[model samples]
Target: MIWSLIILCGVITFLIRFVPLSGIISSDLPLSVKQSFKYIPLAVLTPIIVSDLSIMENKNFFIIDNFKLYAALIATLAALIWNNVLATISIGMASFLIMSNF
Candidate 1:
């Protein structure tokens, strides 16, 4: 049952990711639809950011002492400054490790 559930979840995830691309590539999307597609990344990211910022185990509005949050912020800044994924991840991980020890 566990294996079946995992397989089912994997398939569903794969289909969701592929379906949009398949539709776009297989058919000529209308101009408005194509324009709207450009905002997909922002649409996906907004919910993730909202959930990360607002959701907490103890009903806290902010995670002030959260090392991961600090690390992520540092990473974002590094990415903005350098425009490099490796640098951002490295900085974020370094921040996380340093902050976690305290």
Candidate 2:
């Protein structure tokens, strides 16, 4: 299972690299197409963050005691304020640790 996952990821990585170099997607992309490309990060990040915030270990969901949700909010704020990758990560980790213990 792990090997297949690794191989699959490798193949995906290779294709992501290869497609541009191979000229499969040309630089002649339309204005709309180029603009929509801006959403790729949000498209990728939204599902991961949303799923994490919306799920619980017991297969139930509640927002009242959601320390992770709070931590994520804090982290997002830190990211916006500091705009530094290391600071955002540190703040996120520290906030999660502090919130979860309380």
What are the RMSD figures for all models against the true structure? 4.0, 2.5
Clash pairs, model 1 backbone: none
Model 2 misplaced stretches (Cα beyond 4 Å): 55-61
Per-candidate TM-scores read 0.61, 0.77
Assess candidate 1 and give its TM-score to the true structure.
0.61
What lDDT tens digits, residue by residue, belong to model 1 across residues 1-102? 999999999999899789877765656668898899789999999789657645465676567877777788888899899999899989989999998897
Per-model tally of clashing residue pairs: 0, 0
lDDT of 2 by residue, 32-74 (tens): 9889989999999998997888756567776888877888899
Query: Which parts of model 1 are misplaced by more than 4 Å?
Result: 1-28, 49-55
- Error (Å) of candidate 2 at residue 3 is 1.8
User: Candidate 1's error at 58, in angstroms?
Assistant: 4.1
TM for candidate 2 is 0.77
Model 1, residue 42: what's the lDDT? 92
Clashes of 2: 0
